[model samples]
Target chain A: MKKYLKYVVILLLIPLLIIAGACFYPERSYAFVSLIAVLLSCVPFFLSFEKKNNSTRKIVLLAVMTALSAAGRFIFAPVPFFKPVTAMVVIAGMYFGAEFGFLTGALSAFISNFYFGQGAWTPFQMFSWGIIGFIAGLLSSPLIKSKILLIVYGALAGVFYSLMMDVWTVLWMDGYFNIERFFGAVITALPVTVKYIVSNIIFLIILVPLFEKKIERLKTKYGI
Target chain B: MNSFKNLNPYFLISYFIFVLFISIFSFNPIYLTSGMLGALSYCFLILEKKNILKSIIFYLLIFLAVAVLNPLFSHNGKTVLFFINDNRVTLEALIYGAVLALAVVEVIFWFKCFNLIFDSEKIIFLFGKISPKTALVISMTLRFIPNFIKTFRSVNTSQKLLLKNHRLKRYLNSFSAVITQSMENAVITSDSMNARGYLLKHKTFYSRFKFTPTDLFLLIISAVLFILTVIGRTSFTYYPEFIFPDLSLLNCISYFSFLVLSFIPFIFEIKEGIIWKFSVSKI
Candidate 1:
């Protein structure tokens, strides 16, 4: 079980490495660079020579998880509610570990844009989502199993998402980059931000404990 | 395809540098317009036929909007057309805005073409001389976006299933769930990568591409053009005062050549497209 877990973790790191490369090449569109990186990262899982270690099964599961996470943005969009896809990445992180959480968060946004359409903004999406998952991993302790702690972390994460998203928005938008205009932009983004925060609170309050229970059961069954 | 084949990655990089330099030192309307036209024509000829019309329409709308609005907002320039509540609407502002918009659109169009021609592999090859750590971070960031989005959705849906009413409340609950889950995943990924020696000092790419004689020739030509363009644009200024007089056959030829060079990539793509069509017809 530990060995399998180790493999799953390795699979998650591939996307982050790709993202790091794309960030350096400013000549190319961030979206294009990131997309190619995400696609290439899949090569290891699909083409790896190791067949006996249940690599295929794990790859399929990760792929499905990645794909589902990508679709979360376009299908439901979390317009006013919680960003649905972010929730799954957070949960995945809690159950899995830091690396899985990071990739799940990052790749979910990267791959989804292929269908929704790619743009200059895709990198920001990758960074924002990746950070969210990364933070969750850092915060998660054994105490994550506590119902109240889970709910609080979940709420904090939702607010974190909103803050990061807003920061990217200000960076992308011209006038908002200046301190004078920053307040106005922040005020304008407040409603959406509030919505993001509130939705996250709702998700964490209900889903954290349930997932915690499920993860505990899985760990016990697998003897991890 | 052959045109671009003769023009290597070096040419593209040099051309980009040339454009940036020219944009700073030279701000002539005529020059900017000509450059934009050259880029647009190149892109139009090279890009997929279906996309060209859409881009053209988008550009036209933006051009018109800026042209019409600039006169109202900006009261600069010598050529005045009319007055709005005693504030003069300058023809110069309108023209200048249109040209600026065109320049922006053209640059964006060329970049799109650049993206189609150069994928991640080429980028890595060109830029790998720099720090690998930075490169790896960029690469990882690129792949992370789509994957993160997917996980967010499944988690949300599962949360929704548990909460029937009070939609706002449901969202608040779900938010926390998503954050916690994603973090857990990130940790696992980090551990896995570390275990596999991903953080080692000497990392190698799995694929390889070689530079040929053709590529070298193209690079030399691009470097020369880039240097010449920079010198021509920045060496002297025969503008505003018009003391030395601006119009010269040499200047026109150089400007025209530079424009042509920008389109080489697009031309190559068009050649490939024609070949593809021919092959399909034969099949």
Candidate 2:
């Protein structure tokens, strides 16, 4: 029952909330419900690690990864559109389970927004990074084994994040989805999007090998 | 001494949540203008003068970008300004873009205000009620961010002293070292926390904030004003044409309530300042 709880909450409850919010307030629901969804998504992840000894270890590791992802943004603050946040998130997802990855990705966005300034975009960022991490976790076996696959996934994750944000941009600007407007947004954001993809690939290519060995050692030593 | 900062963490969180929602959803120029003004004044009062100025300039640039970019894509209004790439750039699109810019700016400023008020302590206090473990993780993560950055910088500098030839290789080595060190720190911290019985049930949380009558009053007032503003907002529409409901007594009252809602924090800040000055002079 406890094991199933996570699946139910993530798959059922979150979608239900989004559907309900959209039904009631289409224009505003995305932002409002996305916030709720982000918060809701954290519950299952937190609940998943219930064992007394391991839970603490999991939580601490999560905290460290989230901090690393957030701090990674600061490391590349001088360079426009280049940050290891996505790469770190991907690495976390590859090592930890999907739930942990999602939490780290979402929490990184939520926490870092303290420094960057939050807006309607914050929730979208949470959702984008969280989902990217989730996907990376799902494909972890393949991604971990193949460097080429990992790099490609990293680049795609960048594009995916930008595309998700563009949805918010179009919705906020026009109060509804417009294909032409979205295309225009994509075109306008092309340079930044390219930079994001390049940065993700570069960071992932460099950081994955280093972090993988450390994560493997820790898992074995700590039995995490 | 009663100020916005002294409000209960829960109250502050709820207030910002409500205001942020309204800021994003409401397209009414008057409503957004009030919100923007309220946020701006609050920011001016709370933030350092330099930060305030920097943010203002930053917001203006964003406003211009949105304003300029909207018409290029939209081209929806009745009045076409001109055609670039055969798309009719409309005045309505430009205005919509500007309004969006205003909304974005207003929301950003409100969040700036939020960040100022809701530090990690306040956040942990608010979330701690729901889940202490989660709160602990959040606070720890917040603490680790700066610590990790500092460690990385120190590691980078020390590594640079040792290896001057291969800059890229040196950076990679430092980063890898930082990652391992931070992970070990995380493991040690978690083990210590477990040893300290952090996972024990029925942990007591000590918070400095107490919900007083003033908090209740402020909460009620804000809630009432929020509902009134929502009522006012629903009657208006901005798409295709920006229309206001007929200027009835109720509409006027609701509009005024929203204006007051927007100014509530600013009013509180000013009142607090005046009272502080009065007390200081008396002393």
Candidate 3:
């Protein structure tokens, strides 16, 4: 109960603090609010992982997963907006717990950006993918049991990721979070959004079975 | 590492944070100009000459795009320049858009320099303090990516040799085969880690980011300047009406401070260049 209580408090406090900040500093508040909120949300998972002993194996395996996904980018470079990274991240989440999944998602984005140039969009990508993985972990049982459910979730995750990134696009262009501008940004990026959705669904459908077998085997053999 | 870039990661991060904070939060054109000039100057100093023109063009394109798009969303201020879809595209909104555009562009420029200075080792050094395993994971992933690519290529080649046709099927099989191979490798790695008696506690981190007097001097300057800039930025408001920044003594001094803060890296680089020339001539 105490262990869970800490995260509940943090999750609750973030919005309240952002609201207060926005009230005091309107011009700076939107970016400030978004930045602190996303970064702090990962703190609970970071702290939990930090205290554990025998963390090296988990660390190495997590790194392996992140690398595999990043390498997926190079493999799929011929196709625009079609990478297996999202599929790999979702697979990692479904087998591992939410904490591991979030870190994998976050770390993959950060590490890959070292090769693909980090920008304002980097944090937004990290946050979006991290949330997808965290949600995948939470919904793993349902997703694992039904292939149809898995495909549906994959499509939804792609849409969610695209929409979330568009939010960053709008925020970066204007000084504040403008609804009209956000809609405009979304409308302009519709074709790219479609590509994102199609790519995610295709990768998830194709890669899920193969990764599932490998991950399941590892889990049983090494108690991962 | 170069002399200036070799500052402790914390100091470098602090300096960037202050500039980013001011740039993102303050719509005051003065602050944005200070941040933009300082950022572009540093970027030009470090970036390749061929790429400099390309970067400037990119900056201008984004600037124009943002300025045009701003008034469509925001309907604040007087001096209506035009109307679009029943919305007043005010001149003030255009100015705000330009300010916003400058802030975003400035951040992109600074990050280019930030990425140049803070390599994976600095990343590990920084994260190791707060979350050691996370740092380890990041560094290890950086190492494993190339190895993963090699395995993928080998698997692809083997698939080519086995199968006659069906390119899609061949690629798919190679991807899955690589996954299987990586999993087995991971399991073996865990066992070896257990055998090695990886200590429960020790200096797992070994970063060469040493702090010197130069770092301390830079830190003090950034802190003082950051405070001054923030004070200047916060006193003026940009919404509901267009209020020009008062040309008070305090504003002018703070504006100057912010310029110095932003240009610190560029200034340091030039000073170092001059000193190096002197030493080389003597030799």
Candidate 4:
């Protein structure tokens, strides 16, 4: 009962702190404030809880994961092709679950947007990245361990996110929804997709084998 | 809160539909202004009743700043108020921008109230089956963000205590530490969830919501009012009368009534809070 109560308190505190942070510093860039809030909020989980053996190594791995994914968002931008973020998101989702994958994707976008700027589009970005992460988790089954399956899934996730973001743009753009405009937006997004595919190719070519090997070592070491 | 349980789900859906309809089909200044005014007044009443005046004052200042500062880059309007070098600072643009800012703030406020009223449980109840997987994913994803945030804070402070000497290094170390901690936490959480057969099958769920006859009545009324509002909007020449957006006596009364109608929910909420306070005092 006590444990359950503690979880409830923690769950409630998260949104409250984010709201307080956003409200308290309205003058500061919202994107920057949000990034800081996300970073600052994670500190409690680290100290108040314990980790398994090789915690230090695990933490380093996570940081690298965040940096790799964050860098993917900036370097690749948004596209429909095999984006860097798609690969990373899929990898994370496969390893973790849908929830963790979604967080990773959303936080990556939120932090990156600080470098970009917040607009009427922040919620959409959150939603888009969240969708990608969710798909990654849903698709991450034992059969997906093969590189071909993972890459295929990553490509599909990229297309899915691009389509969702395109729909949002159509809604926000001040005009009647016509077939011409819809197709036009999709065509405009093609270059972004190309960039995404290029980045995904680069990330997957290197990161997957390395991560898989490391996880294998850890599993053997820990007797999982 | 109990009465809120009697509010219809379709009423909520239609509310969003009306919002989208207005935003898409109509860009009339009068319609926008009426919405702005209606929303603003309700927010005012809410703040007054809840004693959130200070927060509103603070946000208003920020709103003003964002509005005034934006036009330096977007100098598009023909009606120029002044000439700063070659560029024109137009009154039309500034006012347009100020209204847009107000609309943005109002939308945010509306969503905040919506969250308070409808909340996660209600959302799950409404849209769980058609897309149960997506709903579960969203709920869990929402859960992780706050969890990550809380853990990040404590871990940073502990790291700060250990590395007390260098300021620049402290910031870098903290950033790296957060990423590391989050990854580890994610793995542990995943492992635990997996062991419980989370992803293997459809998860059974339940909600705290109950539907009553009063809810049905409220739904019908809201739907009728919405249909009427749409008809009135399409059938009448409510604006563009040439003289400074004049409101006829009847129109003025109708708008005022609309404003009052919007406040009905908040008024009930404030009254409940007062009664609860009184009861507690007596106890």
Runs of candidate 2 exceeding 4 Å displacement: A1-54, A219-224, B49-54, B77-85, B238-242
Q: For model 3 chain A, where is the 10-residue window of minimal lDDT?
A: A18-27
How does each model score on TM-score? 0.55, 0.89, 0.92, 0.51
Please tell me which model should have the higher lDDT, number 3 or number 4. 3
Residue-level lDDT tens digits of model 2 in A1-224: 97567667776777577556555665633655555665667656656543334567788888889998888788666667878899989988888877777878888998898888766677778878987888788788999899999988988998998887887787666565667888988998999899999989999998988887897888898776
DockQ of model 4, rounded to 2 decimals = 0.05
TM-score, prediction 1: 0.55
Between prediction 1 and prediction 3, the one with superior DockQ is 3
Q: Per TM-score, what order, best first?
A: 3, 2, 1, 4
- What do the candidate models score in CA lDDT, each in turn? 0.55, 0.79, 0.79, 0.53
Q: Score the docking of each candidate (DockQ).
A: 0.06, 0.59, 0.66, 0.05
Model 4 chain B: weakest 10-residue lDDT segment is: B234-243
Every prediction: chain A TM-score: 0.64, 0.82, 0.87, 0.62
Clashing pairs for model 2 are none
Please tell me what DockQ candidate 3 reaches: 0.66
Worst 10 residues of 1 chain A by lDDT: A172-181
Residue A151, model 4: Cα distance from true site in angstroms: 21
Per residue, candidate 2 scores C-alpha lDDT tens digits across B69-172 of: 87777766677778888888877788778877887777777877877787778888987887776787788888988898898889888888877857656656
- Specify the poorest-scoring 10-residue window by lDDT in model 1 chain B: B234-243
**lDDT by residue for model 3 over A5-70, one digit each (tens)?**
864655457646645554565555576577767777767777778777745667777888898899
